[model samples]
Target chain A: MKAFDYARATDLSDAIGASGCLIAGGTNLLDLMKLEVETPSALVDITRIGLNEIVPEGDGLRIGALVTNAACAADPAVRRGWPLLSRAILAGASPQLRNKATTAGNLCQRTRCSYFMDNRSACNKRQPGSGCAAIGGINRNHAILGTSDACIATYPGDMAVALAALGAQVEIEGPGGTRHIPVADFHRLPGEDPSRDNVLEVGEVITAVLLPAPVEARQIYRKVRDRASYAFALVSVAAVLRMQDGAIAQAKLAFGGVAHKPWIDPRVDSLLVGETPSKALFDKAADLLLEGAEGQGGNDFKIPLARRTLAAVLAEATAE
Target chain B: MAQSPAARIAVNGVTYEFDGDVRRSLLDFLRRDLGLTGTKKGCDHGQCGACTVMVNGRRINSCLSLAVMHDGDEVTTIEGLGAADNLSALQKAFVSHDGFQCGYCTPGQICSAAAMMEEIREGWPSFASEDVAGRVHLDDEEIRERMSGNLCRCGAYANILTAIKEVMESGAKP
Candidate 1:
């Protein structure tokens, strides 16, 4: 809780124009600040910049970055159009945390890796080249896919997983200008540097998240946690499927708690297209989805758990 | 005094102007600056709902938010809900149902339940809600799912559930 100069941003320019870190809800930022994991010299409050609106764009919805998780989940348009987003967000945090967490902050959230949070531990994500303790230490909740020797942390947010499946686009404003990034490509894997979670450049302020037109598909977000609520996902699935005349018309799949980012593969959907929903088909697709999955010592259950979760989510989405 | 930045906030209808450290959380602001100790701080984090408070008609973990961030926002703590003489319906229900064995987490639980009830009234859906657009009925599963954030180590969940149900049935709002 070291003293940091605080300022309020009045507009989009003022927000991104400043040189300090932008804070909206302060749910995740403050936690890291208290843990000393993030110690910015200055903080720019962006909540007052009037970014809380949820508006309609071209055949889609544009959610302002400041909109709280609770508001996003309860929004009538979101519930009707992108029900998977609502369910995914609700699956992550409690009611109180949801009330304070914002859509943009959720997407920009850091991993819940215990080593990264502990300053004493040698975490490459927290301090590059220090070494990753989770690789040798307890790694039960570590990533199973897209992991490198540098870090094994998992992207813990549930909303991003659904957004990745729905093909959502992020609207960002920075010193360069405004740009849109696909949700699938927003987060990065641990190749050489695990410190960087997303492709957000420095001083880039997220403006809104644009979700495409309603997919007339059965959307489902199934999360398996150790506890019934208020727990991180052991392995989760966000799936959207459209069935036409006993055949699959369109399919979108994203897996969470299994990789450095929300695991989304177009081939899973392509493999299922024009095919009827069945256990065998789902099992085959599940195997294909976990093809390159490699579990650490303690997280071996995630392989089978992720497979079952994918199959179960597919079955639930296609259930008559 | 460190002469830190000052923020303005209205608590339970009374506006208070106080100087707060930039790093001080809303929970500390209410407890230390304004002396509103009724809102207990358990974990000093968002995990435990013991620091729950109502901010602009919504329940939030006060410990997770900085005091300077909530400037001009209306906050309501447990003390605002009821008094010793005039107990709110939920307070009365808690008393009758024995909603608590140890009263440390009572304030937070009550505040959370109040805001949760309001959320349900406004058609807000919980994770357990079968239909998002359908009417929110106060059922056992719904109540449990909605109140799952507030933990009670005393194992008074049954009584807490009963108290919340009674208050809901009695149509309570604060």
Candidate 2:
């Protein structure tokens, strides 16, 4: 941790126009700073700006970006309406970290790739154009889908996967004005420019995450990790299904730890919409979801692991 | 934003004013500046709960937060839990149950356990809770899931579980 100036934001404008990285929970950012992976000249503390509200907005819930993961998970509305989101948040971090980690910070969390975190390694995500060490080094936990030759870092978040499955929208405020970005498009695939994780411009602050009306369906979030707790996901699944007359009426599937973004493909749901909920149908849907997934040598197992995890989630969700 | 002046913080019941680097973590501040080395630094990251402490009635990893971020906030570390001659009930329980072998991660484990019990009393739901809306029953599985952050290298999990069970059964308030 290097010497840096710190300023506590008093209002939205103070946080919006800050010249350095915004600090809410300071869980991930501070760790990166300690590793010298993230060296911000200034730290703008936004925890006191009063963005921790979780209120009803229009037909759904609008979660303030500064809401701590613990509070968001324990909110009655979230627990009843969006159990998948709550479960996902709890599954991601331990109780202590969840108390300090914020919703915006979780969504903005960097990759957990060992190469990217280690400054000694040549990681394009850490230093643009340097080189991608994960492409040739130990990449058992790297991304398998939506990866490019430049980088293969995986997005390490559980809440974001559920958010992407629920069709959540992110609210951002910048120098220009406020705007809304769908959660699916918020993160970008690893392309030539793997340095940029999301589409946020300079001096842009995420205000709130808008979750659409809760669907009347069975929701489940299953995360498989190396250990029972406090470890990043190997491959997680968030499945929501609406069953009618022993048939799948609607479905939504999102995967984590397999891609640069929350891998959500509507094609699988479309294929299962009018079909009977069975192991055969789920296997077919899983196969369709992993159609073009290419894997590094060490991470080749993730393709089949993700497919089986998706199938299990679908089975549990559509179970009577 | 130039270098700010010395920040003031309240740990336990004492107020301390120190001129330290803003980038220094709360764990470093307590250990280096205040000489409160009871709180260990196992990983220096949020992954390990060796730096756990109570801030505004909630438990958080001090290593995950900068020292200046806690200015004017009420903090309670392991040193604040009890005096050497007068150990807290939870501490006494840990000793009786032999909850630790190396004792390196004891302070944080106790502090986290104290706060975790309060969270359960307030109807906070955990990922493994059977009934989200029902009372949080104190069981081995629940305690293990809640205390998963605090890793004991000596592997004293069975005794740690016994200590927490004693405290919970005694109906002690944090």
Candidate 3:
């Protein structure tokens, strides 16, 4: 859309220190730029930075930032070890999009809120101090769990939800140094400034995502959307469970399309940790997770929808 | 501002070097500069797959990718798939099945299906695949799910499905 300088970076240090917006895959950023929603003076292409490897680290796997969504999902080790990640990725976007979209790009993608994308609408996420139009207008797809007076935009990604359930960590490289941020704490709630999606500071770049050792659990990623395919989730659930002696030994749950970030609550997992599989127990866990979830006018159905989806996923996962 | 570097990309085995505007999309470059207008521009966003093209052997929305980002990459557009005299197998199937009405989305559909067949051969699973780790079976559901990116506004999906099924059943390399 706007004329800007572009250059490819082959070295990690060059990419990290470049004074330009990082562009990988360019699925989301370029779309926003076309709409004049995102205007950068220059772009530093990181596709050639050699961050595209998916290798084994310790007992787990380290996925490079430049790995495409399709490559990551189709990897043999990923499909066998972390099926939830594979399933979650395949659930989102179309085949063509997954082919070009990168791992870190998906994590850093902006919300699909119409107001945020439409420069005409009053969106605090787009322009701070402006009013949020989705708060009271066409909010059926807005966030219900992490709503603020300023914004209610959903994170709009399925892979992050699975990663949150897997307890993955995001590796960051910046001018200061290299550090890791847990996926759960990476995305921020739209407290007052919704402009910043994640916790990355200025000039910081996501290098890779470190997945902890795969757990011995039955994993499933179930997404409910307006259509069967090529649509964003209305409400999605990622569940990881381990059964021992007919009792739940471990339970991890993360919800998508319901919050500003992948919604995860430890209380729900604690409730189902040692409990035997039952509809009643699953309902309680769902209730605890949906507690205090206030929905906007059009999205009130998501509350019950999320509850039923969560219960169904838990039931299906625990079913013999 | 500093001048951007030149981008060299190969389309249909022909390499071309250009020093164009950094904001130029791959779709625009193919249509306007190269005069390869077989690729259509529907939404100009990633939502519509009208601009679908293969970059480095993978289908991607050309409208969403900057041409400058494709330096040293090989691209295959509808024009490169096959000429009118020598149509690709998928293209021939489309003609026999009447898989299009306006034919605006046909190029994207064929290009996408061509690459999709490769994905199936590689056992890359789709959302419709029951077993993500198991061998892929090309059922009607898998074809529909994989082709959901290309939108045929003329409601010709039934014919499109039939055309793709014919190619798949014939075991022809699309």
Candidate 4:
């Protein structure tokens, strides 16, 4: 790791205005630094900035940026109101990692693309203008939905997928002022500039995540991976469903490990509404969600795997 | 050249203040500076839990944390758990169960299990839990899922599981 200046910011303004990379639960950033993948001249510790609470806001909840994943998942309000969020977090990294990884840190974590982590391989996400090695190389874990000519790395996270399905908003504080960005629009696709992951601007810091009022729907988060635990999702599905008169009243779906961001499409929800839950209906919804999903050689299986996983989650969610 | 930062941390009930490089990990500081060799480093990355330690009562990967970030924090390492002459209940179970062969990941496994039992007592749910909001039941599946962070290359997982279950069944505090 490179030598750097470290400062602990005592206030939000001090943290946002500091000219350095923000550090909270240095689980991801420090690992990248050890590999020299992310060499920052300075690190501003934001753990003490007093954004570590999970409080009730109106009918919804506002989760502080510094709340660790384990704490967030174990909170009584979160478990009772947003059970899927808790389940998604628990489905992610092991107990030790979830204890240290924070809410803002999880959203800002980098992709697990081997080529991107390895400095020797050509990766546009790590270094702009460099060719993408995963496009032709071993892409078994690469994305199939949000692929670009520049990159095909998947956004490896589970909590964000649940947030996207729940229509959560990200609160940002910067020099300009505070602004709220919908979770769906927070992450950007790997287009021309794959180096940038989210819509966070320079000197801007994520303050908290604003979850809307809890909905009267059954929520489920199912992940499929090579291992039973301590592994990233090969393809995961987050589903929120409401039934009325033996028919679907509302449906929201978000997919992970299949795109550059949490993949969500309103058309699939529209198709499921007013219809009874059935494999045929879910297959059609899967068709709409997987539209134009072209996979690289090694990851072609994800296309069908995502379809089956989505179907299974929807079926389990609607089961009597 | 710029001067290193000064940080004060309490480890094993003893407070130490020093000036160190900002880039040095807490794991490195413990092993190299404090000479706490009980906490071993398996894979410098967070993927391997051989460097696990408790910070402020929560277990975390010491290798992924900077020592400077731990200012004013209380850390409990393997040495803090118990000495060789007076081994902790969890440590004694490991010895009787033959939970390890190489013993490289023992400290991390013990620290993690110690904190994990606390999590279970607090009704924290795991992936294996059928009900997220309900009381936690420490089944074999739950133990394996919770301890997945620590990797034992000796394939002593069966013994480790037995040791942890024994402690839990004995109603002894780890």
What's the lDDT for all of these models?
A: 0.89, 0.89, 0.92, 0.92
- Alpha-carbon TM-score of each model against the true structure: 0.98, 0.98, 0.98, 0.98
Give lDDT tens digits, candidate 2, residues B1-174. Answer: 323645678999899886677878899999998999998899998877999999987999999988888867889999999768989998999999999999998999999999998888787888787655455676788889999989899999999999998999899854
Q: Provide the lowest-lDDT 10-residue window in model 4 chain B.
A: B1-10
lDDT tens digits by residue: candidate 3, B41-159: 99999888999999988999999999888889999998899999999999999999999999999999999999999898888999898889888877899999999999999999999
**Steric clash pairs (candidate 3):** none
Q: Candidate 1 residues B53-162, lDDT tens each?
A: 99998999999999988878999999999988999988899999999998888999999999999898899988888776566666899989898889888989999999
In the range A13-54, model 3's lDDT, one tens digit per residue, is 877767889899999999999999999988988888888989
What is candidate 2's DockQ?
A: 0.63
Please give the range of 10 consecutive residues that has the lowest summed lDDT in model 1 chain B.
Answer: B1-10
Worst 10 residues of 3 chain A by lDDT: A8-17
lDDT of 1 at A32: 90
**Candidate 2 lDDT by residue in tens digits, A1-320:** 77678887778898887887899898899889989999998888877789899999987999999999999988889888888888888887899999999989999999999999999999998999899999879999999899999999999999999999888999999999999999888998989988889998988999999999999988889999899878899899998889999999989888999999898888888999989977888889988898999989999999989988988888788888
Clashing residue pairs for model 1:
none
Report the Cα lDDT for residue A276, model 4: 90
True-structure RMSD for candidate 4: 1.5
- Angstrom error at residue B78, model 1: 0.7
